[model samples]
Target: MSPQQKALLLPKKQGNFEIGSRSIPSPGAGALLVKIHSAALNPVDYKIKDLGFFVTDYPAVLGSDIAGIVEEVGEGVDNFRKGDRILAHGKFSNDFAAFQQYTLTDARFTAKASYEKIPSSESFDSAATVPLGLDTALVGLHGNHFGAGLTPPWTKSVGESKKPIVVIGGSSSVGLYAIQLARLSGFYPIITTASPSNEELVRKYGATHFFDRNLSGKEVKAAISKITDSAIGIVYDAISLPETQSVAWELLANDGTLVLTLPASVKEDEGKGRKVISTFAGPHDPQNEELCSSSWAVVEKWLSEGTIQPNKYEVLPNGLEGIIGGLERMKLGQVSGTKLVAHPQETQ
Candidate 1:
């Protein structure tokens, strides 16, 4: 490997992260060592840090989203040799994560990448914003019985059934991508809730109609009903709120599916037949890496062709040492409308 390297280090307990020197991670058999150019912080990033969601070790290097170049390939690691540009969701275990000068990656999740041919003036930050959102959005759409140009709920044939899919928070990182995805699935009205400022933007992403539902589940249900001209077929909540499931239940069509990043509390409501699909989705191991790798290529090709634009981002200065401050900005909710990305090498 490359000897010692600096990494944004998260302490074992809940606390702020620091940049520390550590031995460069060597890619074991079936892994590739990535030289990270930038990493994106998810809400789960902080929740995992401060609240300690799913942790297996302390002083874990906490970045799960990364975009960079492959500096070295481990034995048996093909597909992505050294010098390939790639992006990946951090392998669940910190040992296989991003946020350092180097990250250990699953070879399957990495893919050959070049930003779609644009004006050739775009920066890495712009090109770096789509992977995580795109992957999760795609997964949620499918899990909730929706797919690109296909009726939701995998079935036998066209005579099988039809359903309405509702996408709440259609302007979030996942929500924005969900808008376009639901449209591709041919979901009618593609109901979304966003601030007035984002209504037009969400509509462009393919929301058939828009509504300004701030928090009232009543308003949210009413809006979706009006847009669909009936009950919602399926519901997908990108926002990780505990009560979103309840809101979804109120508008669901009979036997409709509900998908969430968090567990929706549908069982306690006594609706035994309703389906509660928990999207416990994140970076899966070997089985999912290949799927993610291919989906990324599709999303990237769309971006390159201007079929989609990367989500907005806030580029923080100061690199490694600056991560603490950036994390705080995200904690305070100041970093909305964009993802926060940092380049540790630039700070180095």
Candidate 2:
């Protein structure tokens, strides 16, 4: 009936999030109006927020990962209904952002569950964390643009290769999700690198071998070969430093596949048939749009079963007002292995 919804406003280039009144959007056909419960903060949030690369305009509402309830569904929508408990990785183009009390979501991006029976086992703060990280991981795994279709060539059987992919940053939100998804997909021998303190923590997420990144690439490669038995297959480089990408490439067995979150200095090695891949993380990819619903279904199943867990979160308790500082901190790399969550309930 009226407007004046509070949003975490991004006022200008290098600007941060803030609380400000905004209109509550009405959903069009195929879109649902969700009363936002939580907004998951991602590295990309700060990347675009501080750098001003993707803003349609200044003073934008910045959030792409969200979890909440569908308060209203637009005409022609049958996949979800009023009061359905759901979470989503919003389409970044419409900026189906959730730093506000309410936002638009296409039926495609949402995953539904009944909050009553599930008891909201994962807190709102933790729930939104999964959609982004898990979606990214799931897409990489499902694409199989990688070598041996996510299992290494040398493995005895595809079924025995859990974590066959050696993800370089296993403790990262995306990296952690990739490890779990790899485990879920029956890929064994998952290898990853992080701070030494994170070994056991990441192992719980299905990282069969957690190496210290501080080690030389030669040492890291040896560790990888030990579990994968000298057969490195698919690799997901969640943290893509140019040097790191080169290191990941070395570990790949000849004719291996390496998928980097960012494009790296990978070239066609004449003797080795390794292929390099770059993935777009959200709805932008025509490939991703088709996979969105199915992928979310897979992620939702794991969530329901408690087979995967959220990254550690520095969840802000307030709504939009509390988000500004969090975004700034994210820019400085202050939030590592911990997601910054925004609660939109107060504003809603």
Candidate 3:
């Protein structure tokens, strides 16, 4: 029998998660076998259990944000070796998922971790908060088909864009990354809305102007007009709630694209020429593979230089068992401005 590892498994479609044992998978060509240290929870994890939309197989593991140490490297992978600390965005498949002590990771989606180095600001828990949220923001802002079709900062040769961009729910995990990416893309007057308590937090992430989330659509639009005359060409609605979507639509200029992490709540009108693109992020998807690969290639440097900041995280106790309550909190809208992380190896 293969080596056994503790995993949080959803036994069936729309089923409850339970602690279970699964075989540690081996890395195939161009992959790495990772011993997961921290797995961060996202809204999609609970949504998958409730809606059963993303996974077709039963008895599945669901998590996308993974940070761990490489146990073994597969053939053709020369950059990573055994014992290297790394972080990678996981997939829906059981063997590649993050809710287990051990899983396989594609080399292309993995990045080096400085978790062990002195003076390093990153750790497994913090790095685990980055993958899914950052990828969603990247695809929403730069993906031609999945997003606004803006030029990526990594490849663009132009100077500061000086254009205005708005991020709804700026305190959200995806919202945080959207703000950072907006700054990197040279979008000035980065406007965002969040709770008063999170205004400082959002500003630290590069939101040049902040508004109260309670502001009505017209209120925000009127306030934004005073900040910049530049047309609001991109409104990344990381929240995607009906109220937030309405505000985003109000602030968007004609011909502008609204990027949403969830399905658009507002209908696009033919007469307005406005476009709404819902982002589907994950390197496993062929549509996102190329763009994700480019961003993943620079992840290590970005983390090292603090070009990208991980979200604030609270590590849940009880390892795998703690994830259940974390998901419940997320589903109940009890968790805010923070990512919940669990250490799978601590399961007992």
The candidate scoring highest on TM-score is 3
TM-score of each: 0.85, 0.88, 0.97
State candidate 1's TM-score.
0.85
- Give the number of colliding residue pairs in candidate 1: 9
Cα lDDT listed for each candidate: 0.67, 0.73, 0.92
Residue 73 Cα positional deviation in candidate 1, in Å, after optimal superposition: 2.1
Pairs clashing in candidate 2?
161-187, 161-188, 162-187, 162-188, 163-187, 163-188, 163-189, 163-190
Runs in model 1 deviating more than 4 A are: 118-123, 144-163, 266-272, 285-297
Tell me the lDDT of model 1 at 293: 56
Q: State each model's C-alpha RMSD to the native.
A: 3.8, 3.6, 1.4
Tell me how candidate 1 scores on lDDT: 0.67
Q: Give the per-residue lDDT of model 2 (tens digit) for 31-104.
A: 89998888888877778875677676777777788888898999998978898878887755433787888898
Q: State the weakest 10-residue window (summed lDDT) of model 3.
A: 113-122
lDDT of 3 at 273: 93
| Runs off by more than 4 Å, candidate 2 | 93-95, 113-122, 144-158
Ranking by lDDT: 3, 2, 1
lDDT of 2: 0.73
